[model samples]
Target: MFTSAIPSLRWLQGFEAVARLGNVTRAAEALFISQSAVSHQIAQLEAHLGQPLFRRVGRGMELTMAGEFLLDTVGKALDHIRSGLGRLDTYLDAQLLTIVCPADIAQGWLQARLHSLQAQLPNLCPVVSVDETARYVDQVDVDVVISRSPLQQAGLTERVLFDDALVAVCTPALAAALAQSPQPGGFICLEGDAMSATVGPHLRQHFAGWSRRGMFDDARLLLDAALRGLGVAVLSRAVASEALAQGRLQCWPGFAPLPNGSLWLAQAQEPRSALIEQVVAHLLSETP
Candidate 1:
């Protein structure tokens, strides 16, 4: 309240533009204001300081020596301001999105689809955050969000990515062991509590009497455990199909590739940022 130094942001803005453009008309257009208004503000500002800031030329204005000195200071300050805004815009645009998903879904679903997403959205760089036991959507701070949710919120939009089919999977060695021995305990099931929440109850109801020895949150982790012949894991066709085809994963007959893992990509409902909108379009076409 007792400060001797106080400056106006609008005056600085007006002064900066008028100095750079050397014309009130150009300054007004750049500032989105009327030429007469800019003139009035400049007049008021100069009057308050009791100094001449601009000299009138033939239908134009030129910076005075005092204005020249102030211009240097103003230019530096404005450049810094513009630089800050540029950085802020990138952060908001998700030039890179930190995608949060269950560890396995990131590996099985998202990672598999990354090449397609990258191909479609050449500018997008999505960073994956592994969180398999996660229950809620973790993209409040990130630009793009891809995950399954219980329901859509008021400010977020949801797109159906794919309908995933679950099937029990095992490594070739484990499949051979099952083919030879075929006993309950011999079936070293990959234990994962995370699947139970996302795809477990359905497995329990449909594919009964498989050994539950291990639990995992992400499909990639579960697949890895199964690949090592640790146990069987209930995973989606999207997650298991390639592995199965490559002979790394084998399906147990009659399990029916139980229906679960309804994939959804959630994003802000309003689509505030242009980059977010592009990501939504790219994700819709991404195959991973």
Candidate 2:
């Protein structure tokens, strides 16, 4: 077994800044230390490595072969450290718990319940990001992901919110008008960059014969289109609940609820902070 010598972080940092700037003075300025301090740090680092890191070339300094090797290794090490620290910063700011999910959920479900959540946890800072792509679980920076897809990532925990029960809906007037003839021109469908797999095929299978006037990715836009009597739209019951209850949109009869994977609240199993646990509990409680 081989053991590598460990160098001081301060020495490594000084060497990296100097190597990058190619000037001791500039590196010292950047590091906010005296030029002598920077030179001393580099000397200490080179002494540990048993090699000369720089050679005098007129008024300037050039990297030796050993210096080049060290530069490459140390540069990467610094970058990795910086990246890791950035990610750590995200975790440290426990005041905010970021919830990443589909736009439909943001607009239809979470947005409405946001105030209630804030009221329940006054100190809780929740940041909601709308992923039109609906791949929030795959985003590394996301703290909590509400996914319609199954949580397959290793070391991640999931809690099922509710099974997807979707319904075809349009304005009451449109439903009444289209009852006689549910043509292609009276149907709306999801097209590009659709967030969920459940919507398109389910619509096609059930309303296969219904004519489609347009296709879109935005659930809110689709809902708006339905409200304007553009065509019937297939939407998750939770997303369409408010519209249905208020009579803004009415469910078209003869279509039973379409089945899909249950909505899942997913988070990393390890590094489970109390704040994250609190937010997860709140979401579970709010699930209908």
| Top lDDT model | 2
Candidate 1 lDDT over 1-288, as tens digits, reads: 223354687888998999999899999999999999888888877876778889999988888998998899989999999999886666566566656665556666567567666776788777677653333333334544556653455566677777777677777777777677756532333345334575456667544676567666556766777788887666667767567766888887656665666777776666555776766676676544
TM-score of each: 0.52, 0.61
Which 10 residues in a row give candidate 2 its minimum summed lDDT? 132-141
The total number of steric clashes, by the backbone 3 Å criterion, in model 2 comes to 3
lDDT of 2 by residue, 1-288 (tens): 212778999998998897888888989999999999999998888878887888877666789998898889989999999999998787567576778887787777777666677787788777788763544443345678887876577777877887777677889888776666645435775574233465556666676666667777767887778778888777677777667767898887766887745888888785445777777777787776
> What local distance difference test score does each model get?
0.69, 0.75
Residue 188, model 1: lDDT of 31
What's model 2's lDDT at 32?
A: 94
